[model samples]
Target: MESLGIQHFGAFVLACIALALTPGLDTFYILARSGREGRTVGMAAVLGINAGCIVHTLAAVLGISAILMTSALAFAALKYLGAAYLVWVGLRMLLARQSARQPTVTRGRGLSAAFRQGMLTNVLNPKVALFFLAFLPQFVSMQAPHPQWGLAVLGVSFIGVGMLWSMVLAMLGGQVHRLLDARPHLGQWMDRACGTVLLGFGIRLAMQRQQ
Candidate 1:
C-alpha cells in the first residue's frame, strides 16, 4: 500500500530526523538519566516521554491543540505554563547536590518513577503540544480527503523519529558513563550541563510567539 503521509515524504522524514538529532532539552534529559543511571532508566524515560507525546497527539485529535494555535490568549497561557515548568525542572536539577559517582537507581523507585517523571515533564511542557499543532499540519495536503488523518500520520511519525534518536543517545550516554566510571566528577558535570540546557530552553520558549 502507498504511504499515507506528508507530501515530499523524503523531505519530511529528513526534517524530523534532523530535528530529533539536534541536541535539545529532551536529548539532555535522556542523556542525564541514562548516563548517570543506566540504559534501563533511559529506556524508561524514553517510554514515558513517548507516552506523553501520545497524550499530545490525542489532544490534537480532540481539537484542543487547534484552539491554542488559533487563540492568542490560549497560546500565551500554555506557552507561559510550559516555560515555567521547564524552568522549574531546570532549577531543581541545578539545586540538587552534584554527585561525583554514577547515580544508582533506587530499588523501589526505579523505572516507574523515571517513567512518571518523564511523562509529566513532557506533558507539562505545552511547547510539545504546540509544536505538534504547528508542525504536523504543514506536511498534510489540503487536497487530502481527511486532513486530520494526515495530521495523525505525521504526528506519529514525528514521535517515531524522536524515539529512534533518543534510543541511540541513551545507548551512547550509557557508554560514556562506563568510560567515565573512574571519574566521579563527570557525573556532576552532566547534571550541571543538563540543568543549563533546560534553563535555556525554558527561556527560549517563553520568548516564542504563536506563529
Candidate 2:
C-alpha cells in the first residue's frame, strides 16, 4: 500500500501516532485550553494548530524550511518571535483574574481567539519547521520519481494523527475540569500551573540552540 513514494507507510504512521502520544508543548496547550474553557474551544484550537502544521508541510515541500536550516539569522528570528509570543501568552494567563461567577472571553470570541492563539503558537515555532524538514526526508523513498509528494503525504499523516490526539486531550481535559468545577479556586490554581508551564516552555524554547 505504498503511494506517493512513501516507503514503510505503516511504520511511518505508527511513528506518527507515537510522537503524537508523547507529551509535549502541544499537549499541554490543548489540555490547558480544554480545562480552562471547554472541549469545543480546545477542538477549535486543534484545528488552528493543524492549520499551522499544514503551513510547515507546505514549507517543507517548497524548500522553504531548508532556509531555516541554512540561514542562522532566519532561524534565530523565528525562534525569538515564537518564544516572545509564548511568554506573552503565559504572562497574560498568570495575570488574569476570574471569579467563579465571571466567565472569561465570551463563547464566540473565545473560539476565534483560541483558534488564532493555537495557530500562532504553532506557526511561530521554528523547531516544528525544522522537524518537518529533517523528519520527512527519512521516510521518503530514495528511488522515488518525485520525493516531494512523499514528504507531503508523510506530513499530512503526522498532522492528522496529532489532531486526533489533541481532540482526545481536549475531551479528557474537559472531563477533568468538570470533576473539579465545584472548587473555583482549584480552577484558578490550574490556570496558574498551566501558566507557569507555558512560561517555562517559552524560556526553554528561547534557550534552545539550532542543531
Top candidate when judged by TM-score against the true structure: 2
Listed per candidate, the RMSD to the true structure in angstroms reads 3.0, 1.8
Q: What global local distance difference test value does model 2 have?
A: 0.85
Worst 10 residues of 1 by lDDT: 99-108
What TM-score would candidate 2 get against the native? 0.93
Model 2, 44: alpha-carbon shift in Å?
A: 0.6
Tens digits of per-residue lDDT, candidate 2, 1-211, equal 2556778888888899999999988898888888778788888888989999999999999999999999999999999999999998887777678784466432236788888989999999999999999998888875777888888888988998999899999998888767656666677677678778888989998999998
Candidate 1 C-alpha error for residue 173, in Å: 0.8
Note the Cα lDDT for every prediction shown: 0.76, 0.85
lDDT of 2 at 102: 60
lDDT (Cα, tens digit) per residue for candidate 1, span 1-211: 0144458767789999899988767787788777767788888889898899988988886678878768999878878887887787677666677446534322136688768878877886667888887777667775666667777777788899999988898898788768657677766666667777888888998998877
Off by over 4 Å in 1: 1-6, 98-109
Q: Model 2: how far is 24 from its true place, Å? A: 0.6
